[model samples]
Target: MTGVTQQAKSSKDRILEAAVAMTGENLGAGLSVRAVAARAGVSTGSLRHHFPTQRALQEAVLTAIYDLVIPDDHVIHDTSLPARDRLIACLRLVLAPAAPGKPSREAWSTVYERFIAPEPTEELRATYLATAREGLRRVEYWLSVLVEEGALAAGDNTRRARFLNTVVGGLSVERAMPGEASVLEAETEVLGMAVDAVLASREPGE
Candidate 1:
């Protein structure tokens, strides 16, 4: 039983890895079961045993995207660092480049591309949207840390978090678009300004 379980897990991991790799190449280019199975070097039957269907593969791929993009440590837990600094680090880590062909920029590429692709069923669209909402919540938990430590200025933390995420989302779209002329300097400057703007004011300026 243990051996079988381990093999099943290994096969599942391969499928997820293959999907993630495909996502990197063209963002939502080729993610169908047949394509994924070929990339994973597994039979369609074996792939179905793990993923069951297309939506399952997409959800798993979304999970994989977040896992790669989100920071790997609990730096927010350290009492030594100021909440503001920790919060900034958290956001930066999510957007910062991890390595060549890794998750940082790739996450946005996948999102925009996925949105453009047509889904065959409403169920898949709903599942995709749910996964996206899950992606946005990644930083909300760390923002709460800022609130608890009293480092964050008094205001609606949820709105502030969403606002920052929206900024990041827009930036991601810009970066993902073709022929956008990669401008790391300008991009980083804008992101820094956005973070600073959030921390500098509690007015929730309309």
Candidate 2:
């Protein structure tokens, strides 16, 4: 019984990994069941057995993508560091590269494509919205932590989180453009400015 459960979990992980790997390049439009099944080394029938529909596969993939855990040594979780610095770390985290050509912007890029496509399917829209919302929730969680630590001024954390997500979204779009419209330095500078604007001034003359 345990062996069967382990095999099932492994198969699911492989499917999700294949979906993530194939998400870029075409903004997820290429993530058809046959393609994913081929990538995962499984039969289409096998994939369908696990996920009854394409929508189910998409939801599972997006969920798994967001569920990709940051390692314990991630900078944001370094509580010994200042909140402003930690927040900047988050900006860097989001701005990092996804594919060599694309940078770490595929999350927003795919969602944008889905949003503007000739009439997105409800499942596509819902999956992307949930993925994006989860990102904002993380920002809010970080802000609340900083607020508790007295590093950020207490306010409507939800709004603050949305604002941060907006900034990242803008950067993501820029990075996704044809040319090098958004450079890494510019991304860091804007994020630094935004973080400074939000953090509570603790020093006498900061």
Candidate 3:
């Protein structure tokens, strides 16, 4: 039984690795059951036995990507740093890939062509949503950590995480276009404002 369990775990790992490799070429859209099975060198039945559905496969791949992209060693773990700084560093990781100038524009173009200009298929939608949810989860984890550390005021972290993500998303979109001089300064100011808003003391309500 242990041997069978180990074998199943290995198979699942191989499938996830193959799917992650394919994401490098076409984001997460390369995770089709047939395509991933071929890439992983597994039979369709075997793939189905592990993933059951394409959505499941996509979610697993996205989670794997999240683990690779944001490991436990990330800045968020550095309690030596100020909690606000650590949170900002964590948020910046999301923006790092979309560099300024041509690269950022090209990345946005790919996003548009693949998921925006055309009506996305169910699989595409699922993949995109899975990616977004993973991102949100990461941000929420950051907020939760700060709260636990007594660095951040405890309130509705879900709302705070959502607000922070929206700010990051808007900044990502802005990167795709031309910006004034001192773009870095502008971004930093905006990020600081966002961090302050979430950290501010809660007021009395009706």
Q: Estimate TM-scores for all models.
A: 0.57, 0.62, 0.86
Number of the candidate with higher lDDT, 1 or 3: 3
In model 3, residue pairs whose N, Cα or C atoms come closer than 3 Å (at least 3 residues apart or on different chains), thus clashing, are none
Candidate 2 wrongly placed segments (more than 4 Å): 1-5, 8-63, 69-73, 99-113, 178-182, 200-206
Best by TM-score: 3
Q: Which residue pairs clash in candidate 2?
A: 97-104, 98-103, 98-104
Give the Cα error of residue 163 in candidate 3, in Å. 0.9
Separate clash counts for every candidate: 0, 3, 0
* lDDT, candidate 2, 57-114, per-residue tens: 7667655655564321366668888878898887666656453245445655555566
The TM-score obtained by model 1 is: 0.57
Better of 1 and 2 by lDDT: 2
Score residue 115 of candidate 2 by CA lDDT: 68
Output the worst ten-in-a-row residue range by lDDT, candidate 2.
Answer: 65-74
- Residue 66 Cα positional deviation in candidate 1, in Å, after optimal superposition: 3.1
Evaluate residue 86 in candidate 2 and report its C-alpha lDDT on the 0 to 100 scale.
90
Task: TM-score winner between 2 and 3, please give it.
Answer: 3
